[model samples]
Target: MDLLATQQCIKISQEIGWTEKRTIETTYEMKLFNDYLLVKKEKFPVTSIFDISFRKKSQTNDIGFLYLHTNSGVRTYFIKEEPFSLIEAYEKLKLERPELR
Candidate 1:
């Protein structure tokens, strides 16, 4: 798959804590490929992606979430930066190749 774009994001790993809820996060480069979305070795096909949405950062959360709703299930990626560019690119690719859908 050809690389279209890349976004820097965090991948969250939660742990139960007594004092407060805790999460371990790792930075990952999310690659937007011509035919798939790849992050941390997991790949999701562009055709399976049904929609994209943003879960805004709130008081409790420090970062926003980029949601990829796919035919199989939803994949959430944590991000501190704006995802408008990524969404725009994804939409454009999907539109350019409707046969993938």
Candidate 2:
């Protein structure tokens, strides 16, 4: 994994009020969903990872969505939106990677 990218993600998560915790080794998958941003992570030995979604439903719907899943378990979380500009960055990335667009 890219340490710099991970750190940037961490910083963005922090800005959005996503609780940061110390854990063992883990992996992450991030993507965009509609106007929302999704971040998923799985720790070693875990069959499934936690899915976190962030979006602005309204001017006041700053809270985002979070989904946690294990082999036979699932959970959800509602969190405040982050301050980092995800949509802007996504647009920039799309422009840079036209083939992916």
Q: Which of the numbered candidates is closest to the native, going by highest TM-score? A: 1
Question: Which ten contiguous residues of candidate 1 have the minimum total lDDT?
Answer: 53-62
**lDDT for each residue of candidate 1 in 20-84, tens digit (9 for 90 to 100):** 87879888888888889888788888878888788776555568888889899887878987777
Off by over 4 Å in 2: 1-62, 65-77, 82-84
Assess the local accuracy of residue 28 in candidate 1 as a C-alpha lDDT between 0 and 100.
Answer: 82
Q: Write the per-residue lDDT of candidate 2 for residues 63-97, one digit (tens) a residue.
A: 45444343446654444445245445544544555
Compared with the true structure, model 2 gives a TM-score of 0.31
- Give the lowest summed-lDDT range of ten residues in model 2: 2-11
lDDT of each candidate versus the true structure: 0.82, 0.39
Model 1, residue 41: C-alpha shift (Å): 0.6
